[model samples]
Target: MWLKLNKTFFGTGTHIYLCAVYIPPLNSTHTADDLLNLEAEIANYSKYGDIALIGDFNARTGEQADYIENENNSIQFLQDMLPQDYDLDSPIKRNNLDILNQQGNNLLNMCLSSRLRILNGRYLGDSLGYHTYFSKNGCSTVDYAILSKDLLPSVEYFCTSDLNFLSDHVQISFKLKCDIKQYINKKDFNNNNMKKFTTYRWTDVSHGKMYEALNSDEVKNKILNFEITHFVRNEKGINEASKSLTEILDNVASKTCIIKVPIKQKKSKIKKNPWSDNELKDLKSKINNLGKKTKT
Candidate 1:
């Protein structure tokens, strides 16, 4: 069973499909059926632009070869090969278990055929190949994050959490590189508490640069044909025109202005809070260190 969530970037036309899956575990009857169904699902979703399959697959594919390399001069399976990493656990040995079952072989074949890469032990967060599932019986990695090899540019990081207070399966997470500005806070009419955004330090930017940008051909052309480009009489047209101009200015400012984030000036002296004495800070640090285990 699985659920799919798709997001399409407006201007770029990039479609990202995320599938959360839970394949039934291997048993006397359902192993073969599950493998076939999984392969079909992959085939169907691979047609989309960029896709990721994530969840507990129940297949213990430990360090198995996900690709079929050059076997002989006679039969050639897939020319596009999976990237090799010597630093990861050896192909002959795995961090969790050396045993490979029938379910594992089925998963390996499916990945090889579908050109999907498992982002478990090789990627950033869980690069140590730590086990993702723990129980009274034993510990192994059953949860995985799989992605189409073509999405290598979009996949930023992959990791698994060690803490599992709720269930036997630990949490797994992966980040996709996208425009952060899209998710930034906007004005909310429902809530009284407003969101704060990083402000621009206009003084930090050069006046000459700002003048040159506004007087550039792109801005001049838009300003000249502003009326012809937009209908300003109606409320909708007025809002549209305002938004277009705002986007243009924001784009230009993004290139020229510095954001007002925390930074140290070389000439300025550091200011210390009045209440932050060395002794108090030491106590606070000890308290924080003690609290981390309980909170995290």
Candidate 2:
């Protein structure tokens, strides 16, 4: 079995965890059964915050360029695994992108994130593609570098340069802040009493950039129009249900707020003597001053 270690290696909080996974090598041809297993694994693993599936998938980018047999089937494997909370980032179109047609090279290198926000429920792309490593035909490209949608806005730059002499494919690297603290804070905000008091304020402040991305008109429409289906089972009669925009939003909001409680110290029995007269007077004065400042 490929190893699946759970911990926040990049972000600060446990809410954002890095799920390091390694898939056992399979034949280079990429089989349907292999794809099915891959899909199941991804679905099982996606329960964690904004999953990022790194490492080789042994599939070619050509699979994404045009319809090949079983292409949607392959993508469906991944799509099914995505969290119900959000949509994965989609392919971004760039100017001067016709170069792919000129070079007969299709952008197969992909990075998917599910932390995307929806205006209407649709996801948007942030210009995802790959760079050529070399001019030669025998280039090797690492399979995938999926990201969480919420984390994509912070991406300063992403590139894969061609290494003509060292190897066929160029080495890929990206620079993004790995603020584990933020993730930890987010994780703790739901449970920490002190943090909860300030959580909404901090979240509003922090989400300025993230909200901008999700609130784009294009992004909102995509989310609103995305397809969904329902399956039902009944003993004697069957009732199928479908979710509307309002229903989906309400559901998502509820799930997002469900936080795990963190271990805490038992309340201390040690009690201070009733506040001294001077201390009480001083506290009263401070409170009055705070009230005055608020009025101002």
Candidate 3:
């Protein structure tokens, strides 16, 4: 289906035509060839100064094609579709090496024309939470951008991250210092027509009642509540620290009891017994007394 967006912006006369069109979603009965035809039509329309064809083409580029032994069909589709003068580059190419090293899945979301120079480009993996938006389990790149080739030299930095503070798709942006010399050499500047006109003064737009009402009891209470909460947290932290210091000092000042050691005793050797004369005399007297008693 072909649709014409009839709004002409910036005074139309085929000098520099800038357009943004919504291409049909992929795999909707229409084949890749159909998408190519759509791209060719845009290329035809962009024959003027510069053309930037952007949006999700749904065609995978870069590392996505690295594994396929025969990428001719896909590459040929893009070459035939896009204008020959245009340049193509995926900012995701910077992460392509790392992706390949990790054997990652590539979605190839970017392309540029030869007319455009790539100052910088990258896949916003984790810096933007792009993966979470897509419902992908982990961080990955599925967004990208391409700049005109003429604009490459002045590029300062090209980069991305997986921070999910914005849209789920990774945002690709770049900075370029416009070559003022080119415009100067082209004699595009007219100094005589750039003079400033007369001046004007400013006036206050606030209402007298509104200014007075801003200092209401409700506002004062809200401000006081915030201050009280902050002060309470600070005071609580100080109290906790003071109590911890006292406990630590008390533990350090406590007296400790020391243990004493016992000494070892040596054992004596055994002595042999010898017969005595007093023991022999006592035995003879006991035998004689016993014999006399028996005779009586």
Candidate 4:
């Protein structure tokens, strides 16, 4: 195709074989065969380590079945005997593409063969799979980010940025899980810092309420009246605009979104029995006899 780069990152827990590619465009000298070959080359490294393939594949894989889904009416015994296919719970991917082409089929085949899963429609940010490439010819999703099953769980967020960043194709951004279990609101990252604030999961906000509030005239007017151009003018302006927007969102979110604070369970204390006397045992027997007499 055009160009490809392979980089290996060694982590404490795992090693990632990242293969970035810029495959040749659709009707040119390069074609879908190159995509299959790329998958083969990438799959070859699975023997060594985990894989993460991200790049402009020039392959518009619209709303395609990237993985071979398990048979709905498969027999339990047969399924157990042959568990080659991945998880049975196949999630539906909502895409923005109008149609799936040959390149899409080839791309899906590559994903299936490579044992990789696309992160676009699967993540919170790109839940509605946005088109990555746009031009006069039309819009399509040619860029992609795929990861091994193990690495898939670690992806905290994934989204495709708009072309406002000075590019014909939208940029893809993703985050990996990190330990931020507890912390004081910007005080210090130290064990002694016990003054921790109750953190609310903003990511798990009520989208229904959010959209409703944002679409309201009150919120919409606030957004419209505020100078949007000032957002990119200067650092001070950016912060000011961001704070204003955050305030507006937080105000509505406070009313709608439920706060998810982790419950801290207090450890239970156990005490030894105090009845070590024979007399107490006899008294208990007498009480039992009295209770039987009362019943009779």
Instruction: Please give each candidate's TM-score.
Output: 0.51, 0.34, 0.32, 0.52
Which lDDT tens digits does candidate 3 get at residues 33-149? 544454465466555444333334333333443223344556676786778784333332233322321112212212232233222223223222122114455444333334433
lDDT of 4 by residue, 25-98 (tens): 77887445667677777767777667777788777777777766664656465776766874553545646554
Q: Pairing residues by index, what is the TM-score of model 3?
A: 0.32
Q: State the lDDT at 229 in candidate 4.
A: 44
Model-by-model lDDT, in order? 0.67, 0.42, 0.39, 0.70
* Alpha carbon deviation, residue 150, candidate 1 (Å): 0.8
Model 2, span 25-49: residue lDDT tens: 3443534454445445545555754
Candidate 4's displacement at residue 176, Å, is: 1.6
TM-score of 4: 0.52
Q: Candidate 3 regions off by >4 Å?
A: 1-25, 28-34, 64-134, 137-139, 179-296
Q: How accurate is candidate 2 locally (lDDT)?
A: 0.42
**Model 3 lowest lDDT segment of ten:** 101-110
Tens-place lDDT digits, model 1, residues 252-276 = 6765688664443367776889878
TM-score pick, better of 1 and 2: 1
